[model samples]
Target: MIDKQEQSLNVKMYINGEWRESSNIQKRSIINPANGSIIGYSEEATIEDAREAIKAAREAFDSGVWSNLSTGERAEFLFKIADKIIENREELARLETLDNGKPYREAEADVDDAAACFRYYAGLITKPSGQTYDVPAPIQAMVIREPIGVCGLIVPWNYPLLMGVWKIAPALAAGNTIVFKPSEVTPVTSKKLLEIFEEVELPKGVANMVLGAGSIVGNEIVENKDVDKISFTGGTVTGKHIMRTAADTVKKVSLELGGKSPNIIFADADFETAVDYALFGIYAGSGQICAAGSRILVEESIHDRFVEKFVDRANQIIVGPGSDLESEMGPLVSEEHLNKVLSYIELGKKEGAALAAGGSRLTENGLDKGYFVAPTVFVDVRQDMRIVREEIFGPVAVIQKFKNEQEAIKLANDSEYGLAGGVFTQDGAKGLRVVKKLRAGITWVNTYHFTFNEAPWGGYKQSGFGRGLGTFGLEEFQEVKQININLEVEPIGWFK
Candidate 1:
């Protein structure tokens, strides 16, 4: 239970259109990462509770109450949800900041982005249906897309609400009933979103939320035979586990896993813009982003200058509580994550990388009680070093120099994960050429971490399969069927 001394929040699970406590009567504390305060508590659902959510989704899908609605009708509900998000943007943003330890401004932006996602999907749902093809003889053929029954959506803690919308909006717009599992670490905004769902009068069992540990709640979502598909965003290890478990039921799975994305800067690039983006790429979200450009491959010609500028900027970042609004960076999400990041920093030092700036935890002033880490930068990093190769998921960046464009491409593609990469070059032809060579799914030419709802987002190699956002994301929750009709029947001579 959360301490009554701090602010209290409602943290009930939404199952079958009702907000209720966990069946097992267990609860988990929700911490405010900014100051290590107990902000709220959530129902810790058991496996049985998870099964109930799944059953609800299954029944809803079978009922066809939501699935049978016209595309335009479904779009209406999504638009309403978007409207509600805008109406309560500040409140939702504050809750997100409190739960996830991101700056209030960033959390607000996430709220707006989430609303935009729903609106985008709303417009998309009404645009197209399927394709009709002309066939030889008297047969007519066509392909149609239909909902894939009950969907299980498991989202992570970093961009809690936005990631939830990313999965839910598309799943709902595709006309599939959903059972969403938000990370136990940050379930505040998700519970609030369900409140909006109730306000919008979303049909019973059409959308459900189960709050608990991943081992129980998430496992139920993956292994349950009733769930037609599972869309997961988390670490690669957990993703692999979901894949293995879902295989028993042969459920359709779409995973957006980990990344060790590369941000390459060439000497010919705009120096100031490249440097700023390099910092933004890694430092934004405290480097907790899956697409955080943790690996920086700089052209050897400008390596010294870039590192100098980058370090100067990183040192100037104000670290404090997310609610301060004046602070540029906030604390890590939890004590455990902070220690994990510190361990990685130590590993980087032991592996012989030079700490350029901001390499240790900050406990100055009132920040001692918070999980704050200084924006750390390391130069002279080797390609094979753990700091350079792994996803630290902190505000840490490693700088390595590449001699030429060929070497830049080689180093960028050397990773087992290929979620995203960026190349900064002023030459248009050279930028396109390098972009084509990068193995990542999403690559920015002169920009670093800009993503739009209209563009496809996913990765190659071990970064996981399938796509999210844009038209492709909508298609992930749908199944295609080919329908053929014969206008005339003819008997073969051999049959007579």
Candidate 2:
């Protein structure tokens, strides 16, 4: 268990293999959203500090110390990092719960997944890459993948450590240096992750971190010419800004952004299973997931029955501090995010949606001090309602009814965002048929919120572009180069 003094220690930014204070010495108080108490302090980086990090990453890449290492050698570092993460699993999970306001079990699962991600990349990078091609007579051709140097990795407060690992592991595996920035409000776990890198004796300047607000620090990384790529997991609006900024230098950009994914339940689905998964879809992590199934679409015939069971489950969810093992759900990440969620609930009522279960904050049982909101559900919501269309990013969901498979498909794919979606039905063929029509990048037949490190994750359209995880993840950080050789020295004829 983490003691009080250990929990509240000051965390410094990691730059060029050293732990140091911010250039301006600005620090942000890290609050435990579960109890609304100040848990720690993290240095807030300025533009100058962000620039120094980028410079360090660029110099590290150019030095060939890390980039020139063999694939097997680099894999060794990743494997050690993975091993250390498991060794520190319990402490990191507690820190995650304290800093991010997630349930202890959820935090533990995230820690395990984070370690697994590192191991996955370590093995993937060691595989034989590049392909030889057949070409015209006397000519040999091939293609090889090389790392794009000096990556800029920016992750949101939700799933802080896991998302950071999602980018860091692959970039390092591809032999690139990086400037990593975690959200200022939740920098605790990220600081610990960097410390793990230090423990593994990762090369100097190969992995650097700058902690601060996105407006200053993130913009610096996006706008810097020396940074070769930007991998961001956050809101779509910020992603658009990054795309435009990176365009100036034509830096490769990978964005995994917003989602209002759909969870469709047909009448034929197992009643109990459908109801349980529907609650899990939106209530896990207090519905802060990027690919959360916030929009539930049910067949018209069984709509009422489904709503009744789902709302019952939502009300039974225990809302309390993440440290308590009894707590099934935790508070929102911060007071500001809580207000944003509450305002959305009000808007839903004004838009004429009926409140099915909860629509107010939970103040009883000492929850008033924390950023707690009851798991909320709005039924009879129209397809055009803002509450149904927009991503609330909270434990709020909207239910809508559909007539048939085609109608369900239409309703599910109507949204501008298409990150993830799910279908639940007894008919095996029907499940596949519906899943194929859904426009999201990630989908499940009868499950929700189940993701694997071996599969790719991303979205289409406004949900942002590019993929993360699997071999596709390694490809994002690499540049493809084509090469040709003249077996008979015949290249001179064309030039002559």
Candidate 3:
């Protein structure tokens, strides 16, 4: 358990490889969402601070001090960072749980995956890059990939360290200098990551962390001319604004935005497994995941039974502070987010959805001061209901019935966002067919929320563009250049 003594550690911003205070010497309280206590304080960076970080990255990229290194050289730093993360895994996981209000075990898993992400990219970058085209003989045409300079990476609070690493590992692997920003509400792990970078002796300005609110610091990163690309993972509305702001400079932008993904369970699915995953999909991470399967679409024949089973499991979830070893789920990240989720639940009821189980905040079990909402489920929800259409981003699930596969597909694809979804069926062919037609970038046949660092991740439609992870994620930070050589130069003069 994190004690009040941990509050003595003052978190600072990392710029140009140095830990320092914001220009204005401003700071914000870093609250533990589990109990609304001030765990620590973080630097509240200003526009000037953001510019300082950006200028550092821009200068580093132009100087080629870090980017000029061989792929093998860059991989060394990533490998070291990954090792350090593992060495400090327990402390990092505890920080994540306290700062983000996720269970300790989940936070530990995130830390492990974060390390794996760095290792994956370190190994991946050493592979062959660029390709030779089989154009006409002697034409000698080929395309080579190079790093895009000065990336501004913005990640949401939901997966603070993991999401930030998702961008950091690849961006660094591709040899791009970066100005990274964590959500203002969750800066603890990012600060720790900066310390890891410093310990690894990553070149000054290769990676800079600016801790501040999005409106000031994030806006500066987006609108700044020196930044070559921006990769953001957050709300859909913020992503749209980023797109609009980035267009001013016509900078490259990749967004991994919001989703209300569906988990479909056919009557033929293994009933117990379907119910189990459905609960895991929404309740894990307190349903704060962008790809969380908040919508459970069940076959009409088994909808009732599935809902009954799901609700029972949801009610059984132990909601408490992440510090508690027995707690299966933790509080929402903040009170504001908790209210937003509760509002959506109320909207669902008003819209005629049946409140199946656990709608209100949990005040018992020593959770009175925390931002805890009980695992909520709503049945008989309409497609048009705000609760069904919009993202609640909490421990909430709404189950809707579909008569058949066609109806299932329709309900799943009706959303404007297509980040991720899953289906469960005994029939392999049916699962594949439905998954292919789900209109999502990431889908699973028998699993939910299972991700790999080697796989491409992103979404279709409003879920945002471009891919993260895998070879595609590495390419996101790269620019392709085509080279053509004229082997035989013959001047055929048309003019006499």
Cα lDDT tens digits, model 2, 1-496, are 2323245658898999999898776579999997788877889888999999999999999999999999999999999999999999998998899899899999999999999999999999999999999976677899999999999999999999999999999999999999999988898889889999999999999999998899999999999999999999999999999999999999999999999999999999998998889889999999999888899999989998888888888989988888888899999999999999999999999999999888998888888889999999999888899999899999999999999999999999999999999999999999999999999999998899999899999999899999999999999999999999878853465653
Candidate 1 local lDDT, 1-496, one digit each (tens) = 1112337775988999998788776578899887788887889999989999999999999999999999999999999999999999988988888899899899999999999999999999999689988877688899999999999999999999999999999999999999999999999999889999999999999999999899989998998999999999999999999989999999999999999999999999999999999999999999999999999999999999999999999999988888887889989999999999999999999999999998898989888889999999999888889998899999999999999999999999999999999999999999999989999999998898899999999999999999999999999999999999878876745764
Score each candidate by Cα lDDT: 0.93, 0.93, 0.93
State in Å the error of residue 340, model 2: 0.3
* Cα-based TM-score, every candidate: 0.98, 0.98, 0.98
The list of candidate 3 runs beyond 4 A from truth reads 1-5, 489-496
Q: What is the lDDT of residue 102 in candidate 3?
A: 92
Provide the global lDDT of candidate 2 against the true structure: 0.93
- Where model 1 places Cα greater than 4 Å from the true spot, the runs are 1-6, 489-494
lDDT order of candidates, top first: 3, 1, 2
Pull out the clashing pairs in model 3: none
Model 2 TM-score (2 dp) = 0.98
In model 1, what are the clashing residue pairs, if there are any? Answer: none
